[model samples]
Target: MDKDTGKAFDFRLFKRLMRHTKPYRLTFYGVALAAILLSGFAVATGVIAGDIVNDAISPKDADKLLFLSLLMLAILFAQVLSQLGFNYYANWLGESIIKDVRISLFQKMLGFKMTYFDRSSIGLLVTRAVADMQRIGEIFSQGFFVIVADLLKMLTAAIAMLVLNWRMALIVFALLPIIMIATRLFQKAMKVAFIEVRAQVSNLNSFVQERITGMKIVQLFTREEIEKENFRGINEKHQNAWLKTVWYNSIFFPIAESVSSIAVALMVWFGVLQNVANVGSENTGIIVTFIFLIELLFRPLRQIADKFNTLQMGMVAANRVFKILDTESHIDDLGTVEKEDVKGDISFSDVRFGYIADEEVLHGISFDVKAGETVAIVGATGAGKSTIINLLSRFYEINSGMILVDDIDIKAYKLSSLRDKIAVVLQDVFLFADTIANNISLKNNEVSVADIEQAAKQIGVHEFISSLPGGYQYNVKERGTMLSSGQRQLIAFLRAYVSNPSILVLDEATSSVDTYSEQLIQKATEKITEGRTSIIIAHRLATIKKADKIIVMDAGKIVESGNHKELLKKGGYYSNLYEAQFMAEEVA
Candidate 1:
C-alpha cells in the first residue's frame, strides 16, 4: 500500500476490487435499493412535518394531526426495515468477499517458490492476510456503501428544499462549499494517516510474532529488556499514526457543525426578513421543515469524512493485497507429463543456481545416483548440498542446466507427480500441533493410520511411539516442541518412510541427536532405504561409510567421488576431511 500513487482513487484498482463482488451483484443491488428507499424516507419525513405544521396544527385540526403522525410512524418503520436489510447484507457481503480474498492469498503463497519466502517475513504476511483483509471488508460494511446511502439521503433532502422554496434552498446550498472543502482536506489527510497506520501495524505484527516465536532465544541470551525497548518504539509509532487521523477529525468535525448551524441560522434570518419587509407572509412550516432538511443535508457531510477514512484504509489494504495477487514468484507448472512413479534414477547436469541474482550458490555441479543405490553427499556448510536437494525437488528452478529423474527432465513431470515420488527429511524437522499420525501422513487420507504404524514399525520407531501416552494419536504441539530434537527427527523419518517414495533424502538427519537416538535413526534409515534410492547428506563421516558411492564437495564443486576405502586411498579432500573431522570416532 504505497502512499505516493498520485491518484488517491485509482480507477483501475477500484475496478479490480469491484470484480470480486461480481458474484454478489444481487447484494449490491439490494444495498442500492436501500439507499434509494432511505433517500425517499428522508424526503417524506420533511414533507410530513411541513404538512403537520401548515395543514393540521395551524388549522387546529386534531384528526389531521393524528393521521399525519401515524403516517410518519409508518415511514419510520419502513426506513428501519430498509436500514436493517442494508446493514445485514452489506456486512455479509464484506465477510464473503474477505473469505475469498484470504483463500486466494493462501493459495498463492502455497504455490510460491521457496526463494520468495526466504526474504519475506512470516508476521508481515499474516498481517496482510488477516488484518489488512479485514480493512477491505470494512469498505462495504462501514465505508463505501454507507457513504453512498447517506449521500443519497442528502441529495433527496436538497431536492425537497428546492421544490418547497427555491430562494431558501439557495441559502442552505450556499453553505455546502465550505463543508465540502473541509471534507476534501480531511479525506486527503486521512488517506496519508491510514497508510502510515497500516505500515506501523505490519511492523508491529512482524516484531511481535518474531519475538514470540523465538522467545526461547530471547530468554536464553537475556535480550528481553532490549526487545521490550524495541517494542515500545514500535508501539509508540503505531499510536502516533492512529492519532494523526484523530487529530484531523478533531479539526474537521467542528468546521462542518459550525457551517451547518450557520446555514440554519441564515434560513431563520431570511424568514424574519420576509416578515419585517412584508415581502411574504411568515411560513413557520417551511422553516421547521427546512430545519429537518438542513440536518439531513449537513449531517452526512459531517460524518462523510470519517467514513472516508474507512474507505481510505480499504483502498490501502487493496493495494497491498493486490500486490501479492499480482506477484509472479510462483513456480510455473509447465510440464505436461504425469507419472504414478519413477525408476529412482536422479542426475544434475551442469546445474547452476542462486537464491539471489548474480550470487551463485551452486556452480554448475554435476552428480548422478543410480536406482536403488544409496549415495551420500558430503560437504561443508556452504558447499550447496541442501541447494542440490532443493533443486531436485523443484523447490527452485535451475539457472542454466537440467535435473533429471529416470533419464527424463524433472521439469517434464508435473509438480505434484514429481513431488509425490520423492520424500525429504531435513535437519530442522517441522511438525504441526496435531496428532502424530496426522503429522506423519500430513492429512493425506490415502495413507491410513495403519499404513503409518506399519511404516513406523519398519523404521523401528513403532515401540518408541507406543511408549507415548497417546501413541500414534499424541499431539506434537507447535514445531514438535514437546519432543526432543532427536524424537522430532524420528517423526520426520517416519513421515518420509510412509510415503513409500521412490527417492528419499535425509539432509543431516542425524546431526543433532543423542547416541541412542542416532542408533535408532541409523537403524530406521537402513530399513527405509532398503529398496528406494536414498541420498544422505551428513557431516559425520562414519554415517555414510556403507554408502554404495560417496561424493565429496568443497565450496560449490565436487572434489572427489568414490567409496570410503578408495577416497581414503586417494589421500584427497575426503581423506583429509575424515582425518580432521572423524579421527576421534575412528580412534574410539
Candidate 2:
C-alpha cells in the first residue's frame, strides 16, 4: 500500500520500461515510422480538401472535379494503410515486451525466500503479473505511439496554418493557453486518480481471491450474509475509485471541446471579415481550409490528455513490477559444492534464528542425526520444532551458528544440491490442480507412470488410489479439495517417497489422518525410512515410540533426549508432558 504520488512523467520508470522493448527494436522503430507516416497522410488530406474547393469546385470544371475526387480517395487509402501498420505493429511489440516481463516476474517470484511469500498476498502478486502487465502493454499499443502520431499531426497543421494565413492562425492560437492550462490540471488530477484506481484493483482482487478460496468457512459458519456485506463494501470502493477517473475526464473533455469550438468560431469570423474587406482571395478556399486545419490542430490536443493518462498508469505498473525484480529477498546460492549424493547425516551446532530480526525463535538449538537414524521431536506448540525443518532445508537462513550435512557446512553446498537430498511433508499438505500422477511426480515427466505406481504400491496407497474414478490419472482439483484430509496427507507421503531422498522430514504428517490411513502411513513410513535418515515431528507421543531417539523441546530449548523407556524413567519435562498431553489418547 505504498502511495507513490510520482510526477506526471516518471522518467526513470519510463527508461526502465523502454529497456524491455530493446529486444524488439526493429518492430518498435517500424511502428514509430508508421506513426510519422500517418501524421503526413492526415496533413495531406486536409491540404487536398482545401484545393478541391478552389481548383475543382470554383470553376465548375467536371473533368477537374472528377480528378480531384479520385486524388482525395487515393490519399484516404494511404492514410488507412498507414493507420493499419501503426496499430498492428504497436500492439505486436507491446505483447512481446509484456511476455518477456511476465517471464522475468515469474522467475523472480520463484527465487524469493519463503519469508517473502509469508508476508505477501498471493492475489496481489497475481495482479502484478497479470493485470498490471496488460496496462504496461497499453502504453505502447494505445498510449505512447498514438500520442506521438497525434502530436505530429498537430504540429504539421500549426505550421501549415501560419504559412497560409498568419493573422487567422494567430487568432486561433489565442485560445490554446486556456485549453493548455486545463489539460495541465487534468493530467495532474488524473495521475492521482489512476494510481488510486490501480490500488483499488489490487485490493479487490486480493479480497475476492481470499474469500473464494475460503468459501467453505463462510458456509460452515453460516456467515454468508456478513461476507456478502463485506464484499459489497469492497466492490463499492472499487467502483468509486474508477468513478474519480471518470469525473476528471468528464470535467476535462467538455472544456476541451468548448475551447475547440471557440477556436473554430474565431477562425470563421476572421476569415469572413478579411474576405469582405478585400484583403484575401475571393475563392473561399482559404476560409474552407482553415476549418479543416483547425480540427487537425486541436483534435489531437484533446485526445492527447486521455492518452497521457494511459502512459501514467503504465509507468506506475512498471515501477511496482521493477520493485519486485529488484528485491534482495532471494537466498544467496553462492555455495560451490555440487554433490549429487549426500550421506544424510545432519548436525545443528549453536543455531540461533528467527523469521524476524533480533527475535530469535530457535535459541541456540543443537542436535545431531546420524546417517540412517530415525529421530522423533516432540514439543509444545511454538517450541521451534518446525523451524528446525525450515533451517535444515535452508528455506530461511540462520542468524548465528552452523548447520552441517555429512560434516560439511550446509551453506557450502549448492542450494539445489543440498535440497535434492532431503524431502519434507507437512501436516497440512498442498496439491496442484492436476492429475494424481502429475502431482506425485510434480509434473516431472522423467518420473514415469511405472515409477509412480511402484512408489505408491511400496508406500501402501496404490490400492486406495486405484479405487478412484481415474485412478492414477484422477484430477485432484485445486489444493487437492476432492480428497479427504487423511487422503491428502497420504498423497503427500507418496509424493515424498517417489523423490527417493537420502533424508526425509515429516512435520506432523500423521496428525490429521484417520485410523486406517494412519496404519497405512505408518507402514509406508517404515518402508521409506528403512535405510534413510528420518526426522518425525509428532504431537502424538505414541507415534514415535520406536524411534532411535526422542528429543523433547520447550520454549526453544531441548530439555531431554533419550530412548522412550529412558525418557519415561527420567520423569522430568518429557514425562510430565506425556502425562498431560498424550495419556488420554494412550488410554483410549
Structural similarity to truth (TM-score) of each candidate: 0.98, 0.97
lDDT of 2 by residue, 306-356 (tens): 999998888888878888999999889999997776878989999999999
Best by lDDT: 1
The TM-score obtained by model 1 is 0.98
Candidate 1 lDDT, 73-118, residue by residue in tens: 9999999999899999999989999999999999999999998899
Question: How big is the positional error of residue 420 in model 2, measured in Å on the Cα after superposition?
Answer: 1.6
Poorest stretch of ten by lDDT in candidate 1? 1-10
- Prediction 2 global C-alpha lDDT: 0.89
Which ranges in model 2 have alpha carbons more than 4 Å from their true place? 1-6, 586-588
The Cα local distance difference test for each model comes to 0.90, 0.89
